[model samples]
Target: MAKEKSVYVCSNCGQESPKWIGKCPGCGEWNTYVEEIIRKESGPKKVSTGMESVKTRPITLNEIEAADEPRIDMYDEELNRVLGGGLVQGSLVLIGGEPGIGKSTLVLQTVLRIPEKRILYVSGEESARQLKLRADRLGSASGECLIVCETSLEQIYVHIKNTRPDLVIIDSIQTISTEILESSPGSVAQVRECSASILRFAKESHTPVILIGHINKEGSIAGPKVLEHIVDAVLQFEGDQHYMYRILRSIKNRFGSTAELGIYEMRQDGLRQVNNPSELLLSQDHEGMSGVAIASAIEALGLF
Candidate 1:
């Protein structure tokens, strides 16, 4: 048997309340609560997160082994630099940006260039034909990518098991839903649960997963605050639609430094990595201008 109940959840901090409140007691945010239905099963819950369960034990610091984290070369210099060399294995990365900011284009072109590794791209926002059209327009060399349009979390896992891809990418986390939750997709609960499940899968399978997410009107990722804390890295794609230049900034990274950034130029074919940003930033036309000035800056990678 199953029992259902309604509760108010804070969208900003994921605070729960039995009734609506003017302010969230958790994060002190005003009017951030939304009603959600929770379906509770009347039985002992089982842990099926794909991670192996080991007996609880403690080890001394001297007994623990330390090793370097393994990474996969993305082949894009700017991206590689921002990620502190390359994409780390078994890492769950979240890339958030405004609409039409080239988040999907960036991920698509990256995977298309990696032909040696099997990639699984699951998109819930765009259809297969639409993705294919975008891929063709990008004009990058094809790779071993398996595209599937799925929204159900259970079905996605089934595909993951059958395909066994080296890398997995979710086009947008807001659109995915699980059957256990009665709430609609994109709700705070759904995003938190889905991302947590993906994190477990990544750690257990040693496969990297990249999740694309939407931003709220407040210019933050459109989900509970806990969503950002669950992932290993959070990359922000920033640029004005009116400008040709885009910057990939690292907000949080457990495997590397967060001070690094990647620069790119959106072109007709695809995003062209700006290896030497100073070259484009200092132009011949601007040199003659009296008001224009040039200054050297330092990034985590090197001087620019």
Candidate 2:
């Protein structure tokens, strides 16, 4: 029989507590403690993550072949530029945005446009038929793109191993759950465990995993703050739904600088990438436009 342990965790800082309290001792947040159940094993029980063990063996630097890492062209100029010249293999990317913010549209349009890579899109929020309908409206039902409606994290890995897709995209990470964890889905423990599992697999198989995440009312990524630390890159999609343009900004990137940004225009036929965003932002009709000025940054040399 497995033993159970109960602990209160602060949602803000992920600080563990033995008893319930009005304020969190770690982050000083009030009434943020939530009880979480953890199953403890006797005699050092073996842990099974369902799809197979994610454990990896350490390798020496000399063992690896030194060469420039290969990248996959996404076929979109704006996306390529923001991703630091295409997506890198074995990298985990997190795309977070508000509800109805075109996060799904951007990803579906991208995978459908790229026919070179075998893509597996796992949707926990929508059915496969719904995804197909959306694809039809996007004007491309490429045979290269496959959709599976599943919420079980373990089953997702099973399909991945069988299909052996070169690229994998999860519609929303919040909906996926793992049986290895005792807490409910979307909980702090579940989110961290699931993300860690996916990260390990991506590194071991040399495949890229793109996760769609939800944002809170505070305009920050939902769930534990540690989720952002586990991913290789965190890309934020922001813009008002009423606006015609959307911006994709890189908040954190391990392989490249975070100053890169991508712009897209939402249209009836899916998203259209803005090749030169500067031209669009700069007004062409300068006549009768008061207070419109163009300024350029100048660097000056100074003695150290």
Candidate 3:
């Protein structure tokens, strides 16, 4: 067994310190340091030794196949458009947003929409009953979708192996923890490890994964900066809590372009995809207004 020591870590930048400090030297955030236990395992650690020798083959560019990657459509045109037609297989996607901004609802609705695929919906933040209630409210109950309220990373992987789901949905990455790490859930180390594990699973199994994550006070995903690099996609759920409108934008995408955007309207049933958001702005009442000059533009988006 190896000895463990306590170290202060900055929650913002994931910087380590020997002792607690008022501000983080890496990020300059005040009172962001928290003590975390780090263990030094008694084993020869692997470093960048040297590249292993292996048989390799080189193919010309003309010999490479040229075809579109497979995609799983969410059935919602707005969401599908934003995702560059649909979700790519073997991709790890991260969704982040502010609290009470309908991130969970959007994901749940999307999962429900795609009943053709078997998805394992893992939640650490909500009970099974609560999720069922939300699903009921959204009018989306799929026999193919399995819901599990779990927080252990290892257990989740075990379940994934047993179920062999076509897609996996993690409610929030910050709430899950691994057994090997002594640090608490949502810690910098735990978040980083869990995400890497999931990413590995996604790639190995050729299964797509969607991870819901909490945004920090800076409006970025809460975790190490490397977490974003590990995933195949990073999407943001942007919306004002006071309004019913929501926007989904891709910050990064490995399979598609990031210029697309998705718009949704929050209703009692669920999130309704707004295929043409400009239609809502045109009204009979607006036609008679003096200041309203109906300038012709493509798709009515020139109103800005």
Residue pairs with clashing backbones, model 1: none
Off by over 4 Å in 2: 22-25, 43-66, 287-304
Evaluate all candidate structures by whole-model CA lDDT and list the values in order: 0.92, 0.88, 0.88
Write model 1 residue lDDT over 81-134, tens digit each, in one string: 878888999999999999999999999999999868999999999999999998
Stretches off by above 4 angstroms in model 1 are 43-56, 285-304
Deviation in Å, model 3, residue 220 alpha carbon? 1.6
TM-score of 2: 0.86
Of the candidates shown, which would achieve the greatest TM-score relative to the real structure?
1
lDDT of 3 at 67: 94
Worst 10 residues of 2 by lDDT: 49-58
User: What's the TM-score of every candidate structure?
Assistant: 0.90, 0.86, 0.85
- The candidate with the higher TM-score, 1 or 2, is 1
Worst 10 residues of 1 by lDDT: 280-289
**Candidate 3 C-alpha lDDT tens digits along 12-52:** 77788999999887878799888889887887877866577
Ranking by TM-score: 1, 2, 3
